[model samples]
Target: MSEDGVSAGGGKMRRRDLLTLIGTVAGSAVMYRAMSAMALAGESGFTGPIKLEGDPKGASVLILGAGMAGMCAAYELRKAGYKVQILEYNDRPGGRNWSLYGGDTYTELGGFTQKVEFDKGLYLNPGPWRLPYHHQAILHYCKVLNVALEPFVQVNYAAYVHSTKAFGGKPKRYREVHADFNGYVAELLAKSTQQGRLDQAVTREDQEILLEAMREWGALDKNYEYRKGLLASERRGYVSDPGGGTTSAPIPSDPMAMSDLLKSGLWGSISAGHIYEFQNTIFQPKGGMGMIGKAFGRELEGVIAYDSKVIDIHQDAKGVTATYVNAKTGGPPRKAQADYCICTIPASILGQIPMNVGDAMQSAIQALYYDASIKVGLQFKRRFWEQDESIYGGISFTDQPNGMIGYPATDYFSDGKGVLLGAYTFGPAAFEYAAMSPQERVAKTVEYGANVHPQYRDEFENGVAVAWHRVPWTLGCAAHWTEALRAEHYDNLVAMDGRIMLAGEHASRLPAWQEGALLSSLDAIRRLHQRVMTS
Candidate 1:
């Protein structure tokens, strides 16, 4: 619940009721306990900022891809007095952190909000997912931009059930998914303590031991499985992923394809998708996630370009030459010479642009897949979820990519009630949705939202879909992480040829997150700065 017990919708206060509701959640104990051991490393995630030595002369900075990474980089550089120019392929900023406007409350299409590092490390959606602590950089950016974030209270516990429909559809709720997770986790900790393992240095052997014990304890079932589903190649998230050769698999002939996940194929009943879960606590910007972009854009003042697109990049013995297309004009492309060019475009887009990466790194660049997203934000005139500010009931639908997501009218805003909801699609499903006509996508989003929240059916009766897929600049809502690139391309992703510098949420160790984008941006900028400084 929020500090004031106000629903995320700013509905009536319900602290007393929330306390009672939390008691009924059966499995939270096990989840929290199990995760305690695997929390974020205590080491500071960032070191001191790399200060420029007297800054560069004629350092007209060219920052490509105006998502969180690009925006943050531009803001940082501009503050430092560098002549910065942001060339965005999209018409607007805030790549994946997309949102909608028009009502008292804005509709957030991408980049869900959460409380990072609250009492513990950032809470993750183990299932039917959401989080309290996510979007660390976004929140920080919000503060810097003076955007107000509303603290939302829970109307009811975000619940997940393991009924027959859960396998593909939104798989249950937090209560069901995390059943006994907390207690089991606590039990594991107790046992480890007795064995003198608690608080010990985390050695490679220690990690393996913990992994085995965690599997037995059931942490791997949800956490590992969920992680492996999206990122199968490296098994970075799954306990079984690393120690290969079938920890438990009939194994698949085609490891890369999704067909191998069928019930009869290999790991019967559970695939990479089955292992994932969503946390119940998700927050919304007081207005909308879009306000975040709008706010950041404002903070940038005269820096962010509205119709600027980076078309080509060329490098030579002196420095780099960046060619840009004026998105608003049909005329020829405009070119600019810069001391450095920082690229934050998805690898898919990056691969299309001519850079100097040869045969060795070509395959890696080709494999980076941005989970295609087709967001259809439907604006309606009704309370919908009413006073519940659960942010789409903190819903988690594992079944369809076109699942519905929304928040209450009062939660979104008290007066002139309305629901801004949409669909999140990907892979083949994303392609299908991307092919959909604007009208068709709106119909589907409204239909789907009605199904997910039958209580809000009346709200979407004549709703309209404001789709990102149809927008030429926003090819799709932000980007997503997949198993393919993490395994095959982690090395090549960072393999610097000193040609194109890569940074964005996808390029970082953490995928599809604002913090990851910031870290990657800072990383590339620092590296390039250092290279120039030394050279």
Candidate 2:
């Protein structure tokens, strides 16, 4: 092989081949970040606050569902000189963007009601919690609404990464696993370069710089080895404390063996914070994520009709009509008419509602599928994870059915009680959790969480589990969009059908995010305004 490319099994290895090798080892999350950095992946569609130009000329819009999408439409349209009204099935606003607090009551589709027993000043956001900095649309709303924001820690070194099948079922600190993985990989690369194994891939002058970079980046000693030493202890932590006293010498902990570390699979989770969405500087609304929703609701006070369920929707050549009844009490259906309609109801429930639209739109609605998801909030008598384990915030990942446990980002070190996200499950695990009763789901969360934090067994006071599939208002969580499905139905789904248009997270490329919902609503509102002005 020429000196231009590295020799691999008697064949020249290109840069693309090197990327494939790294992607295979580092997993999809790392690969995605790499691709994104290289401009191979899509960027956030949110370009800033949307401007809805033109006038509706006394036209009115009836919006369905009071979630982020519906609320955004009403807020912007009402400001643009259009008469806007929102019909929300729930008694409260912010459909999926909800927070459960003390004295709140929730009755699922199965008639099982759970009265939240959390202490005052404690809350659990059952939906979107952390807001990525790149989601500028939602952030813009938060700023305009004057909603207070706080930093949401995405990764804590003290948190745990656990797998029941690894490390004899014991949880390992994230920092230790992370440091060991990086150290071992860097050391191996440095050794390979020194042995001329990478001569083709790196020039001799670049190799000298690479070796030095690896040594420092990996926390390696003078020998470029990742092992038990002061350098390694600084990154992975020390077994003993270093103090001012004479007998306070710190003991450097031994690094886990490369083979053992690889088998543990704990390194798989270390890349979570590396993902573009969960990277550092993420924020959460003060109190809870629902604060943003509450602010929106307050701003759109008399415009939203609470507890109004739409039973049927029809449009004629003149206008659109929505027949709705009181959601809580059975009553005669009432009609609400408008020149146009914006439907933001999630596809999971929207598919069941009777609506007259084009065949393409109807087929698109039916084809959209929502995934099942479960979130369990467990209130503990004390913040044991913080007090005992020193885990203030961030998430602890596990291979258990519960998937992961998130520590409270607010009220750090408070002497009072705190709530933890005991379980956040999706896919098959979520379906299994949904099949169980709410109480059973909470119990399962505690049971699975104990594997990570043993204090869960003793400190668990009460818990509330939300299974999106069983929730009456939204039969399932956010829309699950496959590329094939998006290619087939996305355009029809978003296109204005007569006087009716659809807007939600599902309508945009960024599924399952508030930004998607906001952007989708903005796009729909712009198109609807254009049509009205032309007419």
Candidate 3:
């Protein structure tokens, strides 16, 4: 050995050097796993507003679809001095950013039509309802458009989490489940430290600090045990709330046993609000989510051509051409020509449209698959949830087919009728709900909701259901991208082919979100503008 404790072959091996050598020999998969273990994941790519400095010099752009992506493209391109026009299948704009209110009619793909009969001022947002605080693009547009926004209560202590297999099918408050889970987990870690099981992992001085933290965080007794007492009750709740009168006093509730708490599985739903995307300070448009779309429509008064169904897209060195027909009349096809094209149509529908592009783009277009989802809105005669159950707003989770019930964030303590998102299902449950007729879907939603809110049977007045798979315009809810699919096709899907570019949630890193659409549009325009300037 050398004087510095080095082997004959080399100096002493450092940890990072060994990792680098292992990564070089083992490949990217090993490197990725090592980075993940070290918590070195990258931050979001979205930085700020995308500035397209150069002008297009009077070049025109034909945008397909009037969804958030398409509309945002049209709005920005027009501002940038590019003559922009949009073709939309639906008479209205906003695409999936829609809301169904009283007297509204919707027809599905199978020719089944439903008329909403909710009371005035009540509505149901079928898609893209809640807006997270981190979705800066969406919030910026909403602010620019002067749309009024209100807080969306994502988590309520009084909200319920029900598992059919647990607690004899009784729904428990979110706070109780959350408090108990944290308390038990903290107690377990504290106990293990005291038993010297974590001696290797934690230093003796640090162990004392950790024990104190766990005791405070878990609301444990002086002995570091999670047990029935006032300490636990303060975090969970009191059996009888403290009263002001001399005859009444608060009674601490008994804490659930650690074994029973684990078996209940109610702890599973507690972390939903903690997710980065669903965290606190979520917001929604005041009247409905559709208000955002309506505001965009109002701003882009004559730019959108309603009821124009695009049949094909062909691009050449000169320009791009799109053929379309009137959706209402099925009239002869008309051609729209532009120097460049930005197609924001969902991949689910775009795959069917005959388009002339490279083989890579064609393959990418057909590779994406849209997700299936269903949302049902129920009109109630009264706000029984607030008056009787004391649940103001937030979601109540269940293991049943309905999946979850979302209380309305607006209209608190009003004497008028209220609307609630009775059922929201996805994946297999969404397909199951979509298979049923609109009326049947509504009836079943009431039935499943009654299991949680017994007042549903009496208070339910009317309902409307929107199964995204049956939506004629979109065919399905939003693009579903897997790691493998994204790795192979995502870049191809977004890259400009000839004079044509794609912009939508499917084309961006942020899928199924308004921010994704905005970012996708901004990125597409930036590239297209660059191409125009160079040419």
Give Cα distance to truth, residue 504, candidate 1, Å. 1.0
User: How large is the C-alpha RMSD of every model relative to the true structure?
Assistant: 16.2, 5.8, 8.7
User: Which pairs of residues collide in model 3?
Assistant: none
Candidate 3 deviant stretches above 4 angstroms: 1-46
lDDT of each: 0.51, 0.88, 0.87
Q: Write model 3 residue lDDT over 354-469, tens digit each, in one string.
A: 99999898899899888989999999999999989889999999988998999999989989999999988899999999999999999999999998999998999999999999
What does the lDDT come to for candidate 3? 0.87
Candidate 1, residues 202-258, lDDT tens digits: the string is 543344344434543443343333222323222212223234464644221113122
Cα TM-score per model: 0.62, 0.91, 0.91
